[model samples]
Target chain A: MDAGVIPISNTQLALSVILVLITGVISAALRLELLKPLLWGTVRTYLQLTLIGYALTYIFNINNLILIIVIISLMCLVASRTAVRGSPRAGRYSMLLGFFSLWTSTFLVGTIVMVLIISPEPWYSARIAIPIFGMILGNSMNGIALSLERLFSEVKSKISEIEALLSFGASPWESVRDCVKEALRAGMTPTINSLMVVGLVSLPGMMTGQILAGADPQQASRPLPVVVMLMIAAAVAIGCLMLVLLYYKKLFTKEDAIAHYV
Target chain B: MPEFFKFDQIEYHMGAAGRTVKVSSDLEEGSILVIKGPSGAGKTTLLRILARLLECDKGQVFLQGQNWLSFTPQLWRSKINYLAQKPAVFNGTVLDNLKKPFALKIKKDMFNLDEAIDGLRELSLNENLIHQDARTLSGGETARITLLRPILFKPNILLLDEPFASLDDNSARSVMEFLKRWLENETGRGIVMVTHNDIYKDISGIKIQELELSEPGVN
Candidate 1:
């Protein structure tokens, strides 16, 4: 092993220490009124990350396709649920839709880019699967959160106009026309910006990690960058598309009766 | 006549400038009812309750002689036009703003754009203004955009909460005149307005009734 290279475990430990120091400074500066929440957040973040690290160690040992899918599906479900809960009146069905849309869209596109185009992987295996899937899930999670919250609040704040539309003989779509447009705009803006700033502003975390593990900067960055790029673009596209689906799936029941479900 | 919109002994409670104002009133179909009182009189609250925007502690609102609580809020709201003083005019061209309300499915097949434009012309607004962003116009202009919005929906009742309060004298006169014609065309569409400024007080053709938010209910 090269002395210049650090083990992944040591690097992970270094990250945890840095995070604690950063939290200590931020908590002190903000002088948070709710110390309990801050404490909980700190403790929970540490425990969650540690638990995931341990769990992945076991999961990575298994080579079953069914197991890989089951684990990823669980991750996707959790991410989607978290996304829906952030919105007011979002429904349980929205989780299924958001999870399916985000996962399939990004996963399909990410695989195409990862294997065929950029760093070729051997039939969607774990070493490649874990990191790429993580990137997709993370971006999709943020996108879903923003769009859901924005869509709900937009409808709520402009409620008078919505009522006016209803009175005007507008269908539900007419009432939420601007809301769809605005939510899409809000949801996609962040991912669009990150894409715009990829190499210029700073080295992304994944790329940095890959390089720390003695991988060449250019070579190590190949798959990860392609993955991030696709994930971000897909995040925007999927976020916009899924929110609309989430709106339809979560907002209305089978009877054409509309409620603030999502 | 099938009552387009009706409220029967409805009670509403909402914070007005800090204090909660309680209102209990009822109105019949096609009747021009005025909610008259000083500032912070809970007039808007009563209007909001009927409009289904403000959920009350306890009460019943009937639209088209049907219990309001029975139907979904969206269905109930679609049947009534609730226009506030500060109309939400998007930062888009006037055509976009005017055509904005038509995007709803309920109003999709219900409105005529040519008639809407003619209605604009009736308000003394130019056709060219339609191409400009609505924000470029004055508050009165914005109010007109909102007023014309319900024209597409063809709501059974128009709930105006001081629709013309901020307009200058000439604009107010023009707006009221436009409203007069619109009301004439708006058959079975009851006009329920709340205002301290009685700009339409002098209009002799349409009957008008005013009620103050009195004791125990007046905030």
Candidate 2:
């Protein structure tokens, strides 16, 4: 049996069909014509993950290091999209800066630890590397999204504080520096809190799965708890930096000008 | 006269509390502009227009013979300080507010920390308050500190929009007297403050320009 295979057997199919019916009923009660889009998104997610999972299984069998790197790059693109919807037009250069700052930091640090520090295999396998990359990327995407939204609204709402600084002869950077810091702080707080209570509260998903597969509980859990911590910490630091940099770009123009959006 | 500061047929759109207003006025150099109306006469707009913080639907502001057409707004902002009716304090200490102008590399060479303390004294604020968090200050203290920050920078012109609205009689009188004296000594520099101090009736030799807001909005 494959470590990560989740086959849509008869019982699973029945459950999925029921879920679809319930979704339709909920949409109709809300008077929203979004049942089809909802189904489409779910179906897309299922099909996409299924194909990618099978493809990655083969790539992992081969144990090709180059293939793993390519997949990680593709995941970075997906992470960037999740961070900012229609981002470049909203603020030019934010998309690229956010994408690089987030994906590169988290991905590089995560890959190094998982591959170099702990596993020390012949080559990094896609099945393990890709999934780990996805986990880190997903958490980073959420962090970036929350920070970007809060950062902009903070700037827009506190136009007075910003203008007060400007009117008192401060530059755009000086005026908005504190707002940007608060925005990043809001984004990173959740991940930091989760880290504080990780092992005491519950056994994490990776550790549990490895134990289920007949691996030594202590051996399986040992490396994973540390790796998980590293990925999350990387995600937070990278996510915070990306948002602050993006926000700076959002507030100012080529002339070091503050936008009079409000 | 190069009209040290002038608003040539300038219009203004300003927001206060939750209400917004639009007004238009022309400001001359070295004018002690008094904006008197019952309440909500868009007096702040007159000051914001001069400061270039509030937008004007139509018209131009000129300072030192330029129509304000090309100066980088940051550079222009470095020149004029607008004191608001209800002053806002930033999240840090009073010293952060005082060192506000030093943030701009363009204005760094011109900033003097000593001048900031002196200005605080002139506004009757305790020198020790410089290290205090802004949130700890009262409405009156905050207002004076707000006034103190801009004055120390000594912008080319001062655009005060009802700065005394939140102060007591003694504090208001003292603030105005100190400001008036400072304006008198600076050549080619101007102070245009909006106030409802009807008692001044006519302050001796002060250039008082009055504007009544009763005109219809331009469609």
Instruction: Report the lDDT tens digits of candidate 2 across residue range B20-110.
Output: 3444445555556666664565666667766666556667777777877677767777677787777777778998877766666766756
TM-score of 1: 0.68
- What is the fnat of candidate 1? 0.41
DockQ per model, Cα:
0.26, 0.38
Best by DockQ, which number?
2
Candidate 2 C-alpha lDDT tens digits along A1-262: 4654444586886688778879888998997987888888878877898897788778878777887777787787777776777343455456776677677776667767676765755537565676677778777877887777677778878877777777765667777887788888877877887788777876666777676766777797787766776677776777677667756755765544456542
Task: List the global CA lDDT of all models.
Answer: 0.68, 0.71
> What is the per-residue lDDT of model 1 for residues B1-219, given as tens digits with 9 covering 90 to 100?
545555655554445434545554545554677888766557777776676665666667676678887866666666666776776776578777677655555445445768778878888888777788777788778777778766556667778888777678888788777766666775666778887666777776866766677555442
Interface RMSD of each: 4.8, 2.8
| Cα error of candidate 1 at position B26, Å | 6.4
Poorly placed runs, candidate 2 (over 4 Å): A1-52, A55-78, A85-125, A202-204, A253-258, B8-30, B34-46, B54-62, B65-72, B91-138, B167-173, B195-200, B210-219
Q: Best candidate per TM-score, number?
A: 2
- Cα-based lDDT at residue B90, candidate 1: 64
